[model samples]
Target: MELTVLGTGSAMPVPERVQAGYLLDDGDRSLLVDCGSGVLGRLSGTGTGYEGVSTVLLTHHHLDHVADLMPLLKARWLAGEEHLEVIGPSGTKSLVDGLLDVYEYLDGRVDLAVREVSPARSFSAGGFEVAARETRHSMPCHAYRFSPPGSDRDPTDGPLTLSGDSEAFAGLAAFADGSDVLVHDCAFPDGTDVSNHPTPTALGEVLAGVDVETLLLSHLYPHTGGREREMEESVRTAGFDGEVRVAEDGLRVDI
Candidate 1:
């Protein structure tokens, strides 16, 4: 499976980084996760135009995570791709309905399927099995794990986990354990009072005993600026031996 980082910044804007977005392609299918601001444009630049996304997984309802939802749907509709599925946490239906209601012009332009999922929900998307769990975030948020069916491998081998936005929730560590790649929310630097998001040290502590191949810190803010090395070191100091790196827009990883 190959995962592409489409955007890495958080709610606040940063010229160097776009907002939260990720693309997971497992040869037969492609899943787009978190289509935040500027993500549609970034995906366009990657040669995978808006129509390339067959499914979209949203972690939360925050604007930073779903800003481009309408744009993407509109683009696909305009491109003659009428069928699309969007899976997300509760309120997803309401959000989409609200958007469509506000922009009545695009109401019947596309056949959009919006599925609302809870933390306990497990389903299939883009030919991959998916599981979600609740996380400690300001809003009702969920972290998702996607696995290849019938694969006798730990998450650290091929499966992937994405921690949407949490403050190092204990359940999240167990939920993400053994994943090959964990795209975690790291929004601030050390010593910052991390509320609803993880700092470098907090994330390290969360993964101290977990078995993960790589921990990709994402959803960055200006507060996390220029502390990449320090963040990695902090995770290492917490007893995790896995690779730790900050995520950048356009970064791609294959497992």
Candidate 2:
């Protein structure tokens, strides 16, 4: 599988980083995780257009995370792509309704389906087996674990995880345990305590003993500037012996 970082900024847009969005591609079968602001354009910049996205999963309803939801749906409609099935938290149905209601003109012009997910449960969507666990964020948030359809064994050689915008949680420690690659929230650099989000220090501590092949930091806050080296070292100090790289928009990583 190949992991692509479409946008890695958290709550704010920064140079080369837009918002929290990513794409996990296992050959042609792809899953889009969190369609935040700037994602539609970023997808094009990455040379991976939105037409190939068959499924989308949102971690929460935060604006930085779901800002471009409707735009993406509309884009697919205009591009002649088939309708997409969206899976999200409990309020997802209502949120989708509200969004469409605002753009009521587009209603019925496009076809869409929705599924409200149960926390800490596993479900299937578009040939992917997904597991979700709640996370500590100001708003309702979830961390998603995805594996290929009908196979626990990863087609890309191992498992892949997307730790949504979240604070350090025991749930996530358990969420990504034994996975091949962990795409975690490093919104802040080490030593920055802003609550409901994970700084590298706390994340490193929690992941110190966990079993993971690599750790890639995403959801970067603007304050993370000038501390990139420190953050990388922090994860290393906590016993994560695999790959650690600060996310950059449009970067593609093979897992």
Candidate 3:
């Protein structure tokens, strides 16, 4: 399976990054996680384009996380794609309904289906098995653990877990335990007073000694500029000694 980082910036925009979006492709199918601002255009760069994605699994309804959702639908409609399935936390349907309500012209332009998922629910999308867990965020959010098809039967295979947007906590760490890759939201560097999102030090403390092999810090704010290495060192200083890297747009990882 290959995971592509489309956008790594947070709500605060930056030239170096966009908002939250990731594309997980397993050859036969692909799934989009979050369709934030600039994400739709980034999709085109991946050779998948908007037409290549039919399913979107959201982490939450925050503007930074769902800004380009409607644009994606419109793009797919223009591309002659007939169906789209969006899965997310409880308010997913309402979010879609509201967007369609505002953009009346886009309504009925495509076959759109919104499915609401909750924590502890296991579901299949784009030929992958996904496990969900509630996250510690200001609003209701869910972290996801994705396993490629047949990987469940392979003892050596490890799933990829995405922390979405959340604070650093033990429960979230446990949820990502044993993952081959943990793409988490480390929105700020250490010493930046923040809520709902974690700083590098805070994230490191929680992830210390966890079984995750690689931790890719994402959802970055512009403040993190030039401090990328420092952030990684902060996490290590706090006790997480695993491979740590900062996410950038277009970076692809194969697992």
- Kindly indicate the candidate among 1 and 2 with the higher TM-score: 1
How would you encode candidate 2's per-residue C-alpha lDDT over 1-255 as one tens digit per residue?
Answer: 677889989777887789988887767577788899999888766545788886788899999888988888888888888777788888999998999889887677556888989654578766777778888888888887777755766422338788787888776888788888888998887666588888887888888778887888988888988788889998888766677887778778776
Poorly placed runs, candidate 1 (over 4 Å): 149-158
Clashing pairs for model 1 are: 155-179, 155-180, 156-178, 156-179, 156-180
Q: After superposition, how far is residue 212 of candidate 1 from its true place, in Å?
A: 0.5
Q: What would the TM-scores of all predictions be?
A: 0.94, 0.93, 0.97
Model 3: lDDT equals 0.90
Compared with the true structure, all predictions reach lDDT values of: 0.85, 0.81, 0.90
- Deviation in angstroms for 242 in model 3? 0.8
User: Which candidate's lDDT is highest?
Assistant: 3
Encode model 1's per-residue lDDT on 1-255: one tens digit a residue.
Answer: 788899999899698788999988766678899999999988887656677787899999999999999899889988999878888988999999998898889888888888988755577776667888888999998888887654555332336999998988668988888788899998999899768998888788878889889999999998888888898899889777899999999999986
Model 1 TM-score on a 0 to 1 scale = 0.94
Better of 1 and 3 by TM-score: 3
